[model samples]
Target: MTAIALKSTLWSLSIKPFKRKGGTNLLLNASDLALGLRGIGWNWSQVHLAPETRPTSSKTTFVLWTLASLCLHIPVFDALHYAVQSFGPTTFGTINGGSIFDDTLSPLLRYSRSTFISFLSGLVIYCAIRITYDVATVFGIVVLRQHPTQWPPIFNSPWRATSLSQFWSKRWHQLFRDFFVGVGGVPMTYMFGRIGGVLGTFFISGLLHDVGLWGMGKGSDAVCMIGFFIMMGFGVILEGFWRKVTGHRVDGWIGWIWMCTWLLGWLNLLVNAWAAKGLIGSLFIPDAQRLPVKIFGPLS
Candidate 1:
């Protein structure tokens, strides 16, 4: 609710008065004014129509793609449910001890286990976000008769991203882009220029994510959560420096390795923090619906 309120306030500050085609004013009609405000206010992504709207054939193609995405994510989500239960919560456990890794296993094996858990947890999060957005797209296009352009994909192939900046700006979900710009980037830009805006945007993002953790009972870990995001901001800056020196964009096999190393290296901090707070153990999916959980009855 706090997040929604922040977005709403930003929207009100940014929105302009409604206009219509052929010089007619939507402001004159009370019903039209209310509907327009509601629609624009609710669209968090701020997807807008281009001068040339898509044809019906494009809509059909979108529906097919959305269906394919849903098919791919459902079974992956189920398997993730199984894997997470098998591993138990807290990959490295708490600072005082009591983690899944606190066993008689070799140090190398424990590190590998923790890495696998971190990647698994990240995949589950990605699947959940994709599935929810895909379902919403289907409902909007099929049931509500909305245009395909209005329901653009929430993600843009994040796995293909070769740099932190590309990953955050182009590949990742952009539902909060304007919110971050409004609350952090724009204000900081006035005082400290573009780089400051970049840093500020990430700082605010980290703070809000921790706030979300706080809302989820015992999930807040400001140090890990905020530190991870700030590090990402610095990573983006480092990439920019590399581009300046090399005169080449971050891409291809080498860039992919660098990106993976950067992300996976720091991923444990955020994932383990959530695990320690009991976020991973929370019943996200009911056992009856999870095939492996139903058969094995949850490993630990």
Candidate 2:
């Protein structure tokens, strides 16, 4: 009986789309439209809230974000060192001294003295850069008495409390998710079912992340990028399944799980940063060393 029910559900989902010609395209287009509207709505909301809190002029915000972006890159480069050093000496030879490759194990292993030092250096540099960006952004907002949302030309927040959802929804790369879900997810869901919608969204996001990394001359970063997509895809499928089984929605548990996962991932990254520093002294500094550099380094 259960098997038959499962088969019936699958058949219904798969065949229904074929029975309606052009329906898939139509639904997809609708999703795209919905996403666009959502984006506009979010932007409008930000604008509406902006005047009440701070200056309406976004020029100063834009300038700060631009500076923040440049500063952010310094740590990103340092993070890359840990990622790169994880490949070890053999991979280095294979790449002709170029720092690129997908080696998952190096980060897991105990570090040598030199490797540790380098990783620590890189980690410190990265942390310093990140801290500087955060502090500067906060100070600017407070001094100008301006709303951070009005800050344009910036993609993400420098402060904490930013979640994946919130970050996607408001702070960093606003409307990107809306556009993806609107353009790809909603349509795919209607045509192919929720699974399709989820997968479609995940795939597009992964592709974009990969492209961004590749554009930065970090093509080897694809491994982690792909891993991220896989995780998200699984997450989507699980959420859908949970909803179906419960005959309603499942968010709180899912949200908690997502947060836990994100934190764990971040912790691992931090550990990797420290390990990298231990393995290669001065090659990278851990997050701890970020402060002094930000304070002492040349200020823009």
Candidate 3:
């Protein structure tokens, strides 16, 4: 039945780039289009690529996935809450005449606790978000027959990242990576080469974080996050220089130790600020109620 189907009079019925010859069947044509995109579509700038897909997940598998995400999220949230403070007017952004140093906790205890919290927040939160997103993407693409594939581009085994540069560029959550690069890196590089690009990218990220804090009504404290990214930009430059000098990157267990130490050692600066503003503790019970019973259940 050669009817006037898929020939949109309002729009141009141009052929797609991936269609094979003599494939007039609209259903098969669409399927080929999807497969073609899934195979070749990639964005190096954002480092996002489609992953291989299964036919569909079983109903039980999908349910289990969701339950796992929720189950994991509670503990993740609790840990984050312990590391930081509850959200208040000052929970995110920095305020005048206030310092996390001024908090009651001594430097020893504060640093130790905040450092542990940071690790948990970094690891668990990223995983939780990834699992949840992938599950949804799977359902939409495979189950409902909507999108092409379900691979996500956010975190990519960041815990395995051997260096700060790799962590930021290749592994860590890269949701805003392309945005920062395009808005700041590209033009700055054109103007002043790679260094300019790095500075611009980190600067833009800092501004974005500050703006986000403001949007959340915590604009009063923006310096800490800004400083954090700016420092990261410089660290990247230093690492690049080191690589050029040494002809190799800081890799392996030694590199991992270096990376974690470098990040966590200075974490007190940012963590303190986050704690002061209650951003770290914004998820669950207050520090006083950080007991397992309060977080889990009544001793059952």
What are the RMSDs of all candidates, in order?
Answer: 5.3, 13.4, 9.4
Query: Model 1: which residue pairs collide?
Result: none
Residue-by-residue lDDT tens digits, candidate 2, 3-66? 2332233335443332322224565444333432222223222211112233346747555554
Worst 10 residues of 3 by lDDT: 1-10
Residue 215 in model 2: lDDT: 51
Top candidate when judged by TM-score against the true structure: 1
Q: Judge candidate 3 at residue 234 and give its lDDT.
A: 82
lDDT of 3 by residue, 1-300 (tens): 001111121113224333344435677456543332222232222344433333334545544554565567656655544433322225332232133443567978866766765565455457556656656555654565543323334456677879888887777766555547766787799999998999888987877766655554554456777787788888788788888999998788877887888776665556555555545434334335656446553321
lDDT of 1 by residue, 102-141 (tens): 3577888876777788788778889988898789778867
In model 2, the runs with Cα more than 4 Å from the true position are 1-175, 218-223, 247-258, 262-300
Top candidate by lDDT: 1
lDDT scores in order: 0.69, 0.45, 0.56
Q: Which stretches of candidate 1 lie over 4 Å from their true place?
A: 12-68, 89-108, 294-297
